[model samples]
Target: MTISRRILLASPVLAMATPASAQGDWPSRTIRIIVPAPGGAGTADNLARIFAQEMEKRLPQRVIIENRGGAAGNVGATAAARAAPDGYTILWTWAGTMATNPAMYSDMPFDPQRDFVPVVLLGSVPNILIVNNDFPAQSLAEFTAYAKANPGAINHGTTGNGSSMHLAAELYGQRSGTRLTHVPYAAPAAATTDLIAGRIQAMFNLVTGAQPLVTGGRARALAVLSPERVPQLPDVPTAAELGMPGLAFGTWFCLMLPRGADPAIVSRLNALANEVLADPEARRRLEGAGMALDGGGTPERLAQYLREEMASHAELVRISGAKVN
Candidate 1:
């Protein structure tokens, strides 16, 4: 038979095996991942880097990260949601963005529940309540006493309303039964600058953002909002250890693709991501940036976790009255 006639005869066999074969080695093209934050060596950026490095080794093509930062991550997320649902474009962002942004703005371009599919849960880190070294309170106990005595007299800086730092400080005040004025900023760097200048008395800052301030001696490390003390900062105690256990919460970043992405493709990407999270060298860089490796489960588990967190954060906002508008 002629070559064309033979190929036509074999077409049925090729079609039957295509689905099974694709599952064996998916991601046959370059993947573009997006970060909904500024371009920097921040915690979330570091995570995207680590994952990209490991994923590039196993996949047929490379993974790239595009930083699209604005409106506290809404811009990038919206862009990712609008991209093709071919599993090539992924969005990796902090859990706070997923949980808090809906409450901040009246309209969002993408629906967190409907537009995306979870890949995995990255590790979590706690925020640090820091003050300029010149401030009087030396410890969590002392700080609480001072704040209680001077309710609303102390002003604290947060990334913005509905940000993790804002909710954290609000939760700290409510749980400790203290009052402090809030001053919101567009970015953490600005808040850090003001905290260093002693314009603000204190701030609930992410460990990554506060590391330089504390090391530079511009800010005092009071208490961390974690269940236990972090290994890196063994000297600093957790808020629970200092009598504010309820203030403890870990901020996390997670990987997600557009909804309706092929299951085979998602599985391939998830496997590579887990391999990345398990790498020791990668883990070190991420941990230094204040993130932990959370390579534990299937996408279903992460989806459930997201739902529960949404409810939990909603209650937190309701009780704290921490609305952005």
Candidate 2:
């Protein structure tokens, strides 16, 4: 054979070997995790920080978290979606950004289903129905009765117009046949402050955020928004046990990479994440923050879970008539 023909035959083998060789040294440089929310004491932010700390130990390179909080987490999510699908930039976001925002916002910058690949679902925590200490009702039953008796008199506070807290409260009202006037706040801390000060009658907040107040006697937890009671609040009844089965709801945190990322990298990240979650100290810290600890399985499982959540949130959005431009 001619020398040129032999060289041509060798080129095909080199081309086939390029991709595998490239994926072998993945994450050699620093990896960035874009958290689509502001840096604060929020559960989502804490979860991101914890996971980053654990992942850096497991991975070869440093993992950094960047808070791009604005437009209801769209700013960061859009940035992540547009990032190169090279596994260097991953999006660590919660339910609002991935599952609920698409249904709540009319104009989303990127489609969650189309632009991202699920890595793993880190954890979840239920919402707790809390009221100011001086509120007349002491339990879920009394609270419902009070709400029904005084139709629009009871005021409920939420993080924002289309936040998970807002939708969960709406679902609670719809299922329990209670009427509540919603008062939206810029942040949950603000709402929490008002709840403790008796400015707002009641609020549905995450267990992680509300647990301290409930334990300190500043606020009272009427019911937990989970199918079964959470361990942190063993005395509190779930919405299902209180005759409001539809009110079972919570927020979940997840990690994802931009679409077209290498499948090998995706699998590696998933395995590493599950490994971090398996650590006893990590699980203790996360669970102490009220997380249910759902370290996800296969990437396909995360995809399916996202789909189910999207559909469920769509119905809630429709019922609550919530929308953002």
Candidate 3:
């Protein structure tokens, strides 16, 4: 049988799967995955590379990642949104691009729901509450008591005003009924530097980024901002476990295709992605980097998750009064 015919027949149940002719020898050439974030050791970039590497092993064609970071992931997201609906180009972005950006930015470049179709939820990483070694608070309880007693005396640093880290901290303060000051930095690295120097008393940074500081003893991890403790920081308790279930928050990465992509391609890509994520090695690598593996079931499930997250983040933006035009 022809390659196209075989792919079409690969799944008999997915009647909506695009016919071979529609996709036109799908994946005939190299595929590009656009990361709507900076090119660095950040979770998004690292995870994208890992996904690409794993995908390469399964697919016949090469998969390449392009970094187009700027404007809180707006630049790359918009580019991906406007790209041809063909499956060749897909977007690999996180909560900032799909959920937070909608509520945080007034002039959003792309409407995530309208512009793209969810392919899979790559994984999630919780933000750990880290404080300088010199800080008196060694645990979440201690920090809460200290902050409540001195309300506003403790200052926390975040990547930016509306960044995920900022929201995580804000959410914590709101739930815990503490009034901590926010000190926005140009980037997490800058914030980390200030944190080590004791310029800021606390921060809720991604575990992947904050792990080194905690491990090196430059900072102390008080708690993880998730329902469950991460394997990377086995000793640290989750916010939920520490009596602040409402403080559960984290950044989740996902893959999406421009809207109107061929159904067959979507199904094929989703299956391939699930296969990659299910690989023990892939899970180990991602988890070691502080990622919580997400069981990527289907495009519809991902879309529902995105919708729920957007609503939650919208509420956060409203309460925090974070806006960027």
> In terms of TM-score, which candidate is strongest?
3
What is the C-alpha lDDT profile of model 2 across 1-325, one tens digit per residue?
0001111111110111113224688878999999988897677888888889888988789999999988888999999999888889999987788778898878889999778878877778788899998999988989999989999898899988767788888888878888899999987888888888889999888888888898888898999987668888899998778877667778878889887777778878899898988899878877876778754566666676777788777887888888886
> Clashing pairs in model 3?
18-264
**What 10-residue stretch in candidate 2 is worst by lDDT?**
1-10
By the TM-score metric, which is better: model 1 or model 3?
Answer: 3
Q: After superposition, how far is residue 82 of candidate 3 from its true place, in Å?
A: 0.9
Best by the lDDT measure: 3
Q: Model 1, residue 40: what's the lDDT?
A: 69
TM-score of each: 0.88, 0.90, 0.92
- List the candidates ranked by lDDT, beginning with the highest: 3, 2, 1
Candidate 3 lDDT over 39-129, as tens digits, reads: 8768888888888988999988999999999998999999998888788899998887788889988888789887887787777887889
Q: Give the TM-score of candidate 2.
A: 0.90
lDDT of each: 0.74, 0.80, 0.82
Candidate 1, 1-325: lDDT as tens digits: 0001111111110111123224555566778889998776677777678768767877678889999988878999989988876777899877667877776666777888788877776677677888888889999999989999999978999877777887887777778889889899977788888988899989988877877777777789998777666666678888878877677765777888777666676777677777777778777877776774543456665666667667767766776676654
Runs off by more than 4 Å, candidate 2: 1-21
